[model samples]
Each structure stands twice: as structure tokens, then as C-alpha cells.
Target: MAASVQIVDYVEQGQSLYIQLKVIDAETGTAVEGEVRFLGELLYGELIHEKKSPLADPVRIETIAYLKTHFGR
Candidate 1:
């Protein structure tokens, strides 16, 4: 069964925006729930001068930058 995805907006304590992706059953048009593990490429950010901040992962930094850019910090 094909699943459709949509982003539900959310904000974290660090003032970063998050996309709560929802997976829906394509045929029945129902929100498919229960621990759905998804593998996806981290969608945004520029690899700046390889320095480290509190954000330890590259994907986390990228996602935060993406949200700030897209949603306006």
C-alpha cells in the first residue's frame, strides 16, 4: 500500500521548527499510525566551516537552518 506524507509544523525549545510527517494510507485515506520508522535524507543546510556547536549532528543542524530560512527566524 502506498503511503502519502504531509508535514505538521512544530517548534522545539531551541526555537527550531520541526516537520511532524504524517503517513496516510493512500487507498483508504486514513492516517496510518503506530511506530512508523522512515528513512529519509536530511533536507537542508550548508556545511559551514566544520565547527561544532551544541547541535552535535549534521542533519540536526541542517534541519534547523532549513526551518529558520523557510519560516523566518
Candidate 2:
């Protein structure tokens, strides 16, 4: 027995993507439907700024600048 998936619908809103799917069971020829949503690409990522690190100040300054440019105050 095997299963196959077919895309039933798709949608995009703001920062999210929604998908609807239909799956069929080959053995019994039964079909099921479901929906799934995924958040769009990640923006800023993880930051490791140890207080005693040599590049701490530089990293902080750069992060601030980036935030101001992208997200405003």
C-alpha cells in the first residue's frame, strides 16, 4: 500500500503561505484533505553577543543600525 499527495489549493497573505493538500490511499482508493500554513522566510537570525567578547561593541552597533533601517525605532 502507498499514498500519493496532490495540491488542492494555495494562498499567500502578508508573511504567511497557506497550502491545502489532498492525499489518496492507493490500497483502498480513499482520499483525505488537509491544510498547512508556513511562515515566510526568516528575517534577522540568532545573535551571540557575549559581554566580554572582543567584537561585542561592534556587533551591537551593527545590529542597531540594521534594526533601525529595517524595522525602524
Candidate 3:
């Protein structure tokens, strides 16, 4: 089954933006209630810098792809 993601919230603290995401199984549309954390930088509403979290790799990748596709680089 394919997976999908939704942006639940965005919070800015200092120079970092904390993204909260809801990851769902596409076929079932049921959310995976897992907490993932990522550290990244955004410039002028665009994602210009990024760092990764080992525990949240999949979610982080999805979030970055989503931001780049919808919000631009």
C-alpha cells in the first residue's frame, strides 16, 4: 500500500521550524500515530536548508518532498 502524509501543524522556534505530520496508509486512510522530529531551515517560506533525524527518516523525507513540491525550494 502507498503511504501519504498531511501537515498537522508548523511551529517556529528560534530559526527552526518544527513540523508535525500525520502519516497515513493510502489504502486504509488510517493515521500512524508516530512522533517524528526533524530540524530544518526555511527562508522566505521556502525550504533552503535541511537536517535529518534517523528515527524519522521516512517522515522527514516525505515532509521535505511535500514542502518542495507545494512550497518550492
Candidate 4:
């Protein structure tokens, strides 16, 4: 199985939310595919899944928030 990550959102210093991620192949230490799964509730209380695939060179992707707790609430 390949390695994967789940990113909820990306809130800038104090701005709107966005998505970010990186891709890597564990076995060969190479760049692989990157996926972003956005999960949230709608006004009617329905679950939503917004997936994104970004093709680019290897780079570090991280959320703007210093800690996950900061966005848990």
C-alpha cells in the first residue's frame, strides 16, 4: 500500500481556506501522486467530499495553522 495523508483545510494567517499537499514514493524515495480530500458539512447537514489532484515537483506542504488544535474548533 502507498502512503497517504488527510488534510481538512488550509487557513492562512487570517484569510480564507485553501488546500495543500505533497507526493512521495516510500519504497524508492521518489515523487508520486498527491491527493487532497476536503471534508465538511453543508447547510442541510450533508457530507461533502471535494478531491483535488495537483501535479508538480516535490515540495513540502503544510497547513498555515501552527497547531491542529487551533483549527479543531
Candidate 5:
């Protein structure tokens, strides 16, 4: 029963980038563990990129910092 998702980590393989997220349950205010369905998309100009994750959990904050730096956002 997750109400929202938060970025947990970002990974790069070759030329592709991947983002990991944590599903948060609104009722308990805690992250749901184990495999969970995930769908995400990124839009750049006229092109769109999509990704999915079956299982995701918490990761170091440094991962998020890296993403911010890499994306210059």
C-alpha cells in the first residue's frame, strides 16, 4: 500500500542510466520491502525513456547526490 515513491539510487551501465526507488506506505510512513512493481519515464526533447523495477529498496544518500550532480539539476 504505497502512496508514493522516492529515488534511492542511480546506476549507470555503459551508456544507459538506471534509477532505483523506494515505495513508501502512506499509512505507516515506512518503506515497503521486497519486490514491488515500478514504472518510470524520462522525457528529453521529443524522445522518451522508460524503466521498470521488480524489486527495490533503500540505498545510500550518496547515490542520490550523484544523480543530482550527473543531471546538473
Candidate 6:
């Protein structure tokens, strides 16, 4: 799988929210195709799936968040 990352929201240096899109192929190393791949309920945002085909779950796309995996823990 591949990841397309972007800062969804930012409010200073310490308060920023990001969104990583799962829109790439792992084996073929290509892009996934769909209209509404990433479906999130984070208030508001624009999410788009990659482009291409699939043999398995190349369609069930989603996003990732890095909310304090607690870097200094």
C-alpha cells in the first residue's frame, strides 16, 4: 500500500492535524482508482482516491492520522 500525506488543518506549530491517504498499490507500485475512496467524518475536507485498477481491496481506501503517537513519550 502507498500513502499520500497532507496537512488537513493547521493552527500554529503545536496544533496541526494531518491526513494520510491510502491510495497506492503495494505490489504493482501504482495508484488506486475510485471516486470516493477515502471517507472520513472529521467535520470537513476533500478526499480523493487514486487512479487504476484492483485485484483484491484496491478500492477500500482510507486515511491515517498522526495524533500524538506521543513523540516524546
TM-score list, all predictions: 0.29, 0.43, 0.44, 0.26, 0.30, 0.23
- Which pairs of residues clash in candidate 5, taking residues 3 or more apart in a chain or in different chains? none
lDDT of 4 by residue, 1-73 (tens): 3323344445443333334434343444654333222233111101111222232211222221222333442
Clashing pairs in 2: none
lDDT of 6 by residue, 1-73 (tens): 3443233333322333333333454545665433221222322233331333241233224232322231211
Error of 2 at 20 (Å): 1.4
User: Candidate 4's error at 3, in angstroms?
Assistant: 5.0
Ranking by TM-score: 3, 2, 5, 1, 4, 6
Candidate 4 backbone overlaps, count: 0
Candidate 2, residues 1-73, lDDT tens digits: the string is: 1545556786778876565655554544566555545455432222312353222344434433443343322
Q: Model 3 Cα displacement at 4 (Å)?
A: 1.7
Top candidate on TM-score is 3
Alpha carbon lDDT of each predicted model: 0.38, 0.46, 0.48, 0.31, 0.38, 0.32
The alpha-carbon deviation from the true structure for residue 26 of candidate 6, after best TM-score superposition, in angstroms, is 1.6
Q: Give one digit per residue, the lDDT tens place, for model 1 in 1-73.
A: 2444444644444433344544454444555322111123233222211353223244334434544455555
Error of 1 at 58 (Å): 0.3
Candidate 5: where is the Cα deviation over 4 Å?
Answer: 27-30, 33-73
What TM-score does structure 6 among the candidates reach? Answer: 0.23
- Clash tally, candidates in order: 0, 0, 0, 0, 0, 0
By lDDT, the better pick of 2 and 5 is: 2
lDDT of 3 at 3: 48
Please say which candidate is ahead in TM-score: 3 or 5: 3
Task: Tell me the lDDT of model 6 at 15.
Answer: 34
lDDT value for model 5:
0.38
**C-alpha root-mean-square deviation, candidate 5:** 10.1
